[model samples]
Target: MAGKLNEKVLLTGRQVFWQDTLQRLFAKEGWDFYVLTKDFPAPEEVFRIHNVPVVLYVLDSQAEPKSWAPELNEILAMCREHGVRRFYLLESLEMPEARLELSEKIASAWRGGEMTVSFLRLPEVYGPGAAPEDGLAADWLEASQRGESRTGFMETEEKREFLYADDGAYAIFRTIARDFAGESLDIVTGQPVSAKELARTIGEVTGKPLSLSVSEASFGGRLPDSSLVRAEIGWSPRYSLKDGLAMAYEALQDEGESWQRSARRDRRINQLRGWKEKLVPYAENLAGALLMVIVAYFQGGTTVNPAVYFDLNFAYIGAMGILYGKGQSLIAMVFSSVILLGVLLRAGANAVALMYMPEHLLHFVAYLFVAVVTGYFADARAFERQSNEWHAEQARERYDFLRSLYDECVVVKDRLYRQIVNSDDSIGRLYRIIRSLDSVATENLFTQAAGVTTQVMGVEDIAVYVLSKDGYYLRQKVRKGRLAFQQPRSLRVEEHDYLKNLIAEKNVYVNRELVKDTPDLAAPILYQGEAIGVVELFGLDFNKWSLYHQNLFSITMRLISASMGRAYQYEAEAQDKRYYSGTRILREEAFREILQELMERRRLQGEMPLGILKVSREGRSCEELDSICGKVTRNEDFLGEHQGGIYILLPDADEKVCNMVMERLAREGVTAVREEKML
Candidate 1:
């Protein structure tokens, strides 16, 4: 009966490859699926698609929230109008808050109504080529593999939840088929496993004894609980963690060859295109030259004029004519007239001066004709050379531009890959940045700005700060290093003097001694619109500033400022709902209490604050308090996982802490120690 239901599902947005896979998975489950490639489609066109009764919006978290909201509403309206009863909102695990809000909005639209709308939250899905450094699951797996037994606040004993790609697809299909009354379903494995356990399972599957050295600090956030999902859908995952790991590993092995083959194909295509472009002009010029030579031969009366040299003169004129074709008509005509005039003058002069000597007169005429012919050939050859040179110059310029673009792309790709591999919020931020920047014409302008500013300011660190409701935050569109800051709290832009000036004046600011003088400037810096936090260019040669460098810096500053403004607007609009929720969340003492407990746990495990803290000698004793220190290190675990905090790993237990803990540790004779934590 379920297989017979003539229902069609529509999936939309970027990452077409993933969407295509999902479509295939759906077909395997007996339902027809249609994918929409555009970011947003017209409501009428969407309605016109044949056989698609249900719309499954697999929206990218980084997509423009405002744009998607209206599109979603319109689709829902169309679904309602067409008597389509079901709508499902599927979200990935990166930005839970945004997903939660989207779910709530969808629920509100359908709740107590005839149509059925529900939200499904998927766990980190893994497949072949799955490494902790590539996908969300891979990020967690990588962390567990790297930090097995190290004591740090970021280190967690709690297990993570992961769903295989197929398992996740199956779960979604099952949820869509099931008749449920709820507004949300967690499409995940209901089992909870610790990081250590997951690592062991991966090691077992790979046959590699991955010795994990866990720092007491827990760097990554905890997985969301999916108990609610299991209860509502009456669905359970078929694959266990071990089974999923094995399948993922096998898939990666099979896909390795395919990935290599695709890369080689891409290289070959590029090479072929380059060769085609090089040969096109040469072919055109050669054909044009041959035609001109034939025409000149016929114009010379097809006679062997040894005395008059008419053939030579005609050849010169014809060659010159073709050469000048690429130029202005006026220029070609002027050169042609000059050649004809010179030939006629020489012919007439010899004909009159030595008329009695027929051989000498004939020789003069022949010489004039030969000179004309040679001149035309020389002109044609010169024009061809110039055309080729110009073509090569243009190609060189284009190649340079493309090379620079490729470098920028590589930088962005690497940054995105790192974020994906780490499963960090920066991934979400970067995705948003890319989406927002996609709408702009000057895509590479931001990167250029960062490079120029770094050189001009003579500062290793530069960051662009945009004014937000809660102060200023560094835009993470083009980050250079690991992101340690949260959206609002981690990257406080109000502290930096240069940033403050930039924001206030809406202009560029240059500070040479930023590090020593500006104590509040953040690292992995943002310059102009790019996130080039800190650049290490040592041994500065103070050469006289050239106009080129100056112009580059000036242009970069403008571009950065413009990009930052656009990014700021996009983020501001996207975060409005979150900003309100954040205010409420922050005001909730329960949330804070939970956060405090987690921070204490992190401290005990030795996880320091997100940013680097230069602990002064005056505060050195604060490291020695074991009881208070333990609470601090362990606080991270209690803080709901996502809240960033400090950790303290005691090296030999002699580290100082708060006044109370310092006195107690001193009395206990715990003098020297070592400790570590996850940031």
Candidate 2:
């Protein structure tokens, strides 16, 4: 359909449960929306169907990155090939660090390349098709309908932002309309709602009492700043949390009604089966008795010794006993006996005389013997048949239950297998990390460690310390965020013997003992099973301080350690290439690369200060100029020659420090100017 926006939008993902909502949202915004279903055609073929200018790849939170990342990369390549200008990645806020890592991996190749990729991070989304892990509103509504309590595996006090599916889709529409690109925008409400608050809201919406049981496990919430996106795109949620819950409750109510109708149909079928079982045996017994009565009436009603002549009746009794078991067969025997006595009375044989006669008594005894023996055996056979049927039913039920369990296990196995194969923290990610670190110089490993920790762990405050060769002290190499000013410059081994021993043993030392001045998390970078350096975190969210995060920290540190260890070995082999001959200053190319990385950090973090002092040679020799500048600059400074001028790169420096460095250089007969606007 042609609408306000002429460019078509293609929505695709690993799993697209909200396609309908998105379609509706796009329609309301007067844009053509085309959905690519499971049948993924060739990229060229897809373009033939709809020449779309924008592609929105919805990231499935339930799926492992490996399963979908390759496909996404292929699409990105296709977009670039076809001149698609705008591409959006819609992702969840759960495992934010993982999301960040995944986004980078997908967009790494296209950093400065074509086909701009933008990330739109969403909070927990709730709607009719929402899963339990994605949204709690649907779960609470269903529980309320069933009059049951839902168990939560997170702390009751933990609050998380929730967005409706329609609103989320609209956010995407707004981003496309506004042509937002080359930026990661978080689509959130900014206000986090707790479980208790949501539960109460659901109860109000459903008109049922809500009950929630919280466990010891805690969940971390990400408070993404969405103010910029809101201001830029002019978009906000149209529905409140309460209104969204009400709509979800209505959807659940419709589903419940459908389930009730199906249940009623099943109940009726079972009732018919019950009736067939009850009436079949009784009908057979009645027909057998009627046939026997008709035969006796025609054979001899007035004949003498009718009981003897009516011997066929005994056959009928045995057949009934075999067919209908003891109870029904006994009824048939009584009917036959009444018929025999009536015939004998009609033959003028007095009832008293007949009872006295030994022949008549023998007939009566014979009949009684036939009925009792057959009934007993028939009853036993019936019990055996019923026992077999009961066992079969039990076995069938057990088989169905086991089959269900097997299916569940298969699903879980496939999911776990994919995660192990392609997860952001899996072996593939580790390999990538090692490859990324392999290119870094050994002296810059600490800076790389801090950057990796921030991107992989989603924490800003980090510090890296290098162990001295004497093994008696640790000197801080780099510090980021507030940690730069919080911790000491150096730590003595003897002063923190407990922490030192733990680190030497290659174990992550958590601040569980509540040691004052200790970081929230600390781990050693091991080289050959010995501590070479330590990574410490001074600031961490209370919600994120869990065993899971601790384990993650440990694993990440080990990876960094491996990279550092490898870099150190390479550093020994490439010493001459890393620096100018006979000087501590780094080569120009090496210094520029490091500077570019620091500048990237400043752009991303928005706070790292960098100062560069440009010193003129004034017709002096290169070696003499280097010696004078090296003496005045600190060990942290980088001195490099660029365009026939010696430049000093001061990290973590302010305007005042840059001016001081300039003065020092001027006193050394080298006229230097502080480059206040360093890129």
Candidate 3:
């Protein structure tokens, strides 16, 4: 084996599980490894901090060659500046352009042959959380899992080359350490293991009978030959088909503690709980209004004018109902104005009919006055009914929103529990816990915001990104699910195709083309007071033109921008406090104390629950403080201070109870700032 190289390694791109496992394995063998994430601290900063002498580039098979080429060049330049003499390209599969371009770049950079470049191509890897069912083993395992027959692609009938994840990590380390004397190596066992035999092994391990049917269709695409790898790196897989299957089976059995599991549990609960129930009566009422309109159209009375009045009245009522349900005062006013105009016209026609009679005209005038009053009362009644229905709809919306908020809280709590268990260290761990907790809270808020967009603007997949000095970072503070951030290599925001077109024009760009070409782009997301992102929605019926859509988009944008602004201020203040504290001790301790104080004050002031508790120094637990605080406080005084003191402005509390509570807090050595007044 070659001696280990004294260098730090930076890993990036998809295959997080692979990267994480590699980092762990490398560290165990005394190699410094740093995992580069598309999240916080930015990409270039990762290079600046570690400045590793050797660069290992991991390429995914699906990545665009045009995009990857420039990125590779950038990484190469960075490596050159750091005095790196060697670059290694690790790939799962070969893409013609990516392989050719990368090799050409490496050769150009090493004109004198003083620098070395190597490529390691890996075969099918099987372990825990690994299988073709997951798309990585698309040629074999995935097909088998789907009960499809496949044929062997290789010319040899009994080709055998399979490696476990741990073994692969070990092999990579060994190859790098020796600086193997070859330009390319096949990291595979030369033994032939047929596709049929491998499927049977997996079936036996899973206890799920899988039939292997091999046909000409399966043998269409041949695996890239790795003869160069075998000759150069001296790499050979130790895990056979049976051994790899056994390990994978064990891993699959123990994969219950992942984020996917938690998400699945949540989805199941939502399906079974039956809690998003809407009041059926209001829906029925709207249906009835619609039915009336239909009936009025069919029932042509003695005169067409009377039938017209009935149709007009039905439409007027339905319009009022819709406006009321949406809580739009302007729409309701417009509807009422149209109906009043119709009534005035009808009255004027009746007056002209009674103009020739003397005795009969007096009776007609009296009836006309009575009809006008009746019309006024009828309009008032419709308004009242619509108003009541609106209130009911609002209540239903609020209930649904609260229920969603509760479910999200539960998920956040669970994530926090896992984070706490996996974390190590006091200050850093605590910071992580706080950050995670903040993220959970933020996700809930963003979800609510998304709900608002959906309800008001009929948009889906709303995402908010906060503008940062480096670029746009996901406002994880108000997001749901496993929020991931993507850092653009350049600071020019317009480079992104979607954002580029949106920012170029200062108005909402409705792309009919998006619906036809990219239907997924329909979900509208607002940012910086405009609709920055939108995806085409399915099953939308646009029968009428209404300003409500524009209003909804505008309002959603404003809300998101304001929320992002607030979240930015918060993160900024936190970073500032960390910077000014100087000593790590004072900074960390002060932060914790500040957090605890904020929690307590929020509890007293009935502010929204925002903090998580540490089970140990490293682990965090979500605190169910929603039940503790009956209502969220919107007041500023409770959140303004850095210390952990409760300030009560008790104007409504009973004097005796207030005094008693104050005395108890004092006894407990808790400071309280209070203003006493008679209730």
Candidate 4:
């Protein structure tokens, strides 16, 4: 059953490797693409939301049919119920009869409905992004890069065709773009390569020995015929075998380099430990021996009986034993005994005669006893400390590894969320942009204008300026993206009369006249044929400088203008209720609603910078507080009164800007602290 297709595409599968590449291609071709993963809560809800005319069900041959078949059938039936009449079942030719079983199942599931199912049987797909277990080529490449021999890993004498990931994605993209359906097509390269040939080619590309043994006489099932796909969809592989292998090899090299860097860091740490263990104790022993000799020299002949003075010698020996282990302590004991004998000689006592003295003998025995006892305990303590350190190191390493994994998971989840929710070319993005400006508060509208302009126009360097009260200047209220360098904070209308007049006439100004410091595109945020503000696009890709993008910029500015006009009208009708009687500061209730709206916008926009500063009254009257703060705040800044405090909302502001605002308030004798939890 052939039917007209919509601009939406729903891609669902067990493991879809080409989803990202295909998403980019679809976005470029003006299609709203959505992915329904196995973990998604409700398939029926997605089907209803997208209302796509086509569904792409990719079948992973490696997965057991029993695991995915029932779910696939249920989804197919749901798609039929949701007005999806076209389906393309992307499968691999390596699977034997699995394609037939799946196709038959889909047919049975949609028996009473007008369903058109097409099968695109692909060859072995491999590229840089392919997982190691994806195919034989990827597996072999992984083993070779890991310095592993694949000599007998899988002794198959078969020649199989392989398709690069991008090429396969392009084939499917063309099929969908051309609306080709209801037919089985084999998508592959014309020539098939044997395992030996593939192994050698990968070896050459990666500069590593594959060490694989492939049988000379290769045999395999019939290769897929790609001529039909080529003729119908005008698709062909853009990468040759060598070129594809090279790309994969380069990617593997990048990963290998990172691993090598980590390995080298570990080696350096181990070397430092080796030096500490082997050399540090001997250095300590030498320094301790020298200190003992110095003490012996200073104690010269102070005691009439040198043997009695030798009591201090016992203390030195015991201290050395406790500090160093048994071996080094014994060496230090020998040095101390020598120094004591020299001191005795200097005091006119014979060494042999002193040995015969009972006190002297007792003192010598005490020295040996102290050294042995203290050294043994010291050794035990050292061993215990080392064991504790080892356990702590292990625990620390485990904690660090777990933290790294958590951080990686967070990054991957954020990336996927961005792709699905905030993709640049989806209709949902446009809808979100429009909805962000739907607030009737003019302050809220101005707060959201910069972000919405950047997101919709796909430009990084943008500046928003509002027309000053007397129309003397367009003062810069908000700047988004990379305008970090110094730019003028104010633009005098007389300096740029051309731009001012054009914007007054409700026309967008492109930088075709070569005005210095002028943005690439500037449009008026018009309210009743008068310019209230201007949105300037300072930078964008060259491809966006054409008539189409200029027209788009013009239209986006008009949308913002209309929203601002409506907000102004609403403000006039309920000014006193929304704000305090004399100031631009909002009341408590209106402030709460605005906070909720801004937070929702932040969440949807991937956590755009939103800073809230809380200014406490500190026993001052509301009138006095407002009078002081109003002079320091910008027109774009949102000031709200709540609970005897003033909360200021600064949109698209980071720490630097927040600090500047705090400083200004400090100069005015007002205390303010950033409310981090409010965001």
Candidate 5:
């Protein structure tokens, strides 16, 4: 019967007679069940573990001593939801005329479809572990033990049926085996016993006089007929009332003896626990004080100076502060001061009055001051430790936000570094051209530009020139390959459509005729909108090129133009670089005029406002900063050195722009602070 079963049952109560009887009868059988007690898991978890198809809910109904327990409706509701049929055990179906609150709800739910329940009514069951307060058999036994002559309760001649615990348990097993669903049956012994006759029978068993005194208020009901229950279960009681009473009295005698031994053990344990609680605290403090004195004795002890122990005393104060807080630290400090004074008096004082030895008086005052200050700080330290827990929670929320920003910056830096290193990109082409002009020693500007352009552009030839220093005629610096020029020897700024377009529109022509049959790439090399030189590539097939690649290469020419301008200016002048005159940045006098021009234009045109930035470097290297300024500032803006600092005039920039410039300068070994101002 117990080998393997697809279905299981839940027996939800801890009553000794009913559950123990069922557990022993169903042992090694297919009717597997679980008994829920106080230590069992929560009700929802119990449903998940057992998954029983049937529930025998005994706690909320007749098993509990109260008329109705809270779990009665709750356990029934859970069984109904899981489609588990409920088998309810009871003492009787006949309710008193007045019903309790829980009983009223039980009647309502039974009428509705919320509860599917069957009843199995039992009689007054007597067995081991039955309380002396419940049932007439135990009550009579308690009177005989106390040497009372009689017990007062119940009508003297009122008769009630009796059933042994084992007989009632076997009847329940037979009823389940018969599969009696939703049937109510009174499973009793059908043997009546009078209340007075049960008291005399208990006296005979216990060898003590016992009798019953009739009370006016009593339960005089008779047990219901059990003819149908006997037929349905095919079972009958195995024990008569006289035999059951004799066995029950023997069990009560054994239980009274066992309680005497357990009470003695509990009393001894309580006595030991009471002593430990009163003495353990005093023992710990005494141990700590003794250890402090031992440490002081081992240190250097000079002659007749009690304050030699001051340093060691302070160490104890700090340790006590962190352990038990400020109040205990002050107490430790006071105790040590008293100990020091007592030792000094016992040794022999150097002087008794402050007038004789003023140094000794100052040491005593210093000792008191140290204790007061240390105690104040210890209190603050404890408060800070408590407050720091709240601040740590706030900082935890911002940690994730800061980490995301740091991760985003790392990805951007890697992408930018890769673009500058690849050879096929525009930034790569510009890097190569700058390296070529920076490394060469040729004085002529176009000679170096032609060599680098040929390598980077893969062109047949390149020719370069710039306007003469007086700004009148074009002066040819160098030429390579056979690039014919159709312009006059001294080209005027107003002559030729290509030169007019280069001056007016700042255009770079590619794969189009410049003079006549020269259809390649040619650009106007302008430095900050002034013509510096020219670079032309020959034999380029424009029909085979993407518009994007041509435009990207056109952008590379502008970057090359700025580098060529610096090379042209350096070639023309060989004088020493002054602070402002020969350097790339402007002088103060030039900056003043540019500022005036920008302010007037902003007032008239209603354009975006301008910002002035003052950058301080604190006299670190200005050479690195000058080069960065030449690259960072627009041609329309002004950069000047003033008072060991740099000034930048941003015409269409705001405070945010000033901060961006400060960040870029910081990367070039310059620590700059920008104070932005609006015009």
Candidate 6:
């Protein structure tokens, strides 16, 4: 709002109350904020045009909350594609008609380890600029001071939670200050007070007693459980309903009436959509200028002053502003100059007509004028494009430059790369060697060696273990034959003796039993101060396999190891997550594992056909569907979300029973595409 954030925070909300409050709070906190009233990040230009590191969406969908559901998916996809590392979405948990069990189920479905997408359901809001419907606490305070009772929104004995404006700001600060792993936190004070209790507390704080009024009998339970939120973020609001009501009373004593009087503007559609609206008129102008001129030319006007027919080129000049730097107006002006000159030099001109040719020179001058006007504005756009490219090139060069701390290893890499393609001036054969090694997968490392490579080298087997992403472990990715390893998956650097740090060269070990008359070659493959894998060779007759083959083997190792290292590095960064930023729904692998275990358990107990039902949300509320399943299904029924659907695996249950469950779920509130599969 004022200063800059540490990085840009994309705030997607149109409300003046909360957005304005957050802007004031985070302005001086070294965070730059950019608001997107519309959350679609299409054309990439909507988001890629900015350096947004994080997206914070404040969803105020109290009215037609379901309508915004589809937009959220689109916004999230765009955010993910643009490499937005994290998202923090805040909305209220309480829905007007949502039952306690149903709403909790929906919220739980939205929970999980997709750490990038977090939805924080804040407590009932009240502050300086609270909306009319949202000003419960503020309204209560005002009524208490005037000894009047306001009761339409309040139900007798109904419980609700409250957070002050300052506390809401504080909660927002803490939410963004730390990293959350796709967990929904309820920013509540953990205390739920009834309407009468709320009014009494405010009355005591305001020093004015309120006359109690309960016109009807109604029951409202306590607020939703937010203990999970408090535990996950390790944050607790300092304001209780009593304390917050007192703060709201004094600070918002006279402000409530004013805030309620303030008119609420309708949410704005993305104003950026207006940018392309110019294309329509620009296309029309081009067609209007060209189409009419072509018709005029065909109607035979070359001998006369074509200036009248070509006057539409001025319209083209105006259109140039829409497509600045495209040179459309310049091209038209140049072509018009040709036609105007042709008209002036016509031989059919008589004495009076010849005098008209000099005066008609003003038409040519007009062409030059249009060109200058269009070209001036067009050059501004061209300069901006060139300036952007220049800055980007400089940034790339600066970023790639290292300060001699770790770049010294690049020298070794360069030397090895040169050796692959530069072998004693016979570059063609060396180039072939590099290509063959690159194409050879680790699975075929030995098969290729036994082919044309066997004539040059006799290596029995090859195993590969690339460095893990954390840089502390090595994973055995691929191997041709039976590998000598005790670890099931991977080994840490300090776990294996041969896999220890071998930075300079391959540390070879002599094995006598590899051959009766020959020795085995075994060594830790080293690259960049870490042991990638231990390569071992058996039955290599040094007498037949000369030094040429030994050198070839070294070159092959260099190419293969570097490729493996690069691949492992990419995989670790892209796929490895400390925690997933999605709901606690099972992944495909986890679902399969659970299915197998359940099937096995059922088989041991007895024999039965396992019923597997896959339900696709199909543009419906996934959270609502999840709730229906939880409520209607049995405890033993396995329900997990996979591939954009809820998979319900019920052991010993047939299709008939599955249909019954589906019917019950539909009654509860899930409408989805269902398919039954037997396992």
Cα lDDT, model 6, residue 289: 53
TM-score of each: 0.37, 0.43, 0.36, 0.46, 0.38, 0.35
* Number of clashes found in candidate 6: 20
Span of 10 residues, lowest total lDDT, candidate 3: 613-622
Screening candidate 2 with a backbone cut-off below 3 angstroms (N, C-alpha, C), the clashing residue pairs are none
Cα lDDT of model 3 by residue, 45-141, tens digit: 5665566656677765556666666766676666654456667777653345556556556535643333466676666566666645433332354
Candidate of highest lDDT? 4
* C-alpha lDDT of all candidate models, in order: 0.49, 0.76, 0.48, 0.77, 0.59, 0.57
lDDT of 4 at 316: 63
lDDT of 1 by residue, 109-213 (tens): 654445677776665667654555445445444444444432223456655567777677766776777755466666757676665666667678767655555
State how far residue 386 of model 3 sits from its true place (Å).
Answer: 17
Positional deviation of residue 291's Cα in model 3 after best superposition, in angstroms = 42
Model 5 lDDT per residue over 493-572, tens place:
55545655665576776554335644366677787677655555655545424566467546656656766667546644
**Alpha-carbon RMSD, candidate 2:** 19.6
Task: List residue ranges in candidate 4 displaced over 4 A.
Answer: 1-56, 74-87, 98-108, 111-117, 129-132, 139-159, 176-183, 194-218, 295-679
Ranking 2 against 6 by TM-score, winner: 2
Question: Cα RMSD (Å) per model?
Answer: 29.8, 19.6, 31.1, 23.5, 37.1, 30.4
> Scored by Cα lDDT, where does model 3 land?
0.48
Across residues 1-679, which tens digit of lDDT does each residue of candidate 6 receive?
A: 2553376777774364756778777776777777775423322444655747677766654646455555555566667655677777767646454532333344344334222666677766776656546756776676776678665334545777777777787777777767664556677777777767776787789898766655564434336677765766667777767776766676665664555555332112333446456565456545655654574476465523365644554555546533654466665566555554554455365545655676666766776677777677777778888999999989877767753524656654655554443433256554555454442123233223223232234332333445554556755433332322222345576654444534234644454344432225444545465555555454455553455555656665566566555544543463323112333245565566557655544433243456777765656554555566777665445666556556877655677877887787667655544454445
TM-score of 1: 0.37
In Å, residue 291's CA in model 5 sits off its true spot by: 4.6
Considering lDDT, where higher is better, how would the candidates rank from best to worst? 4, 2, 5, 6, 1, 3
What 10-residue stretch in candidate 6 is worst by lDDT? 446-455
TM accuracy, model 5:
0.38
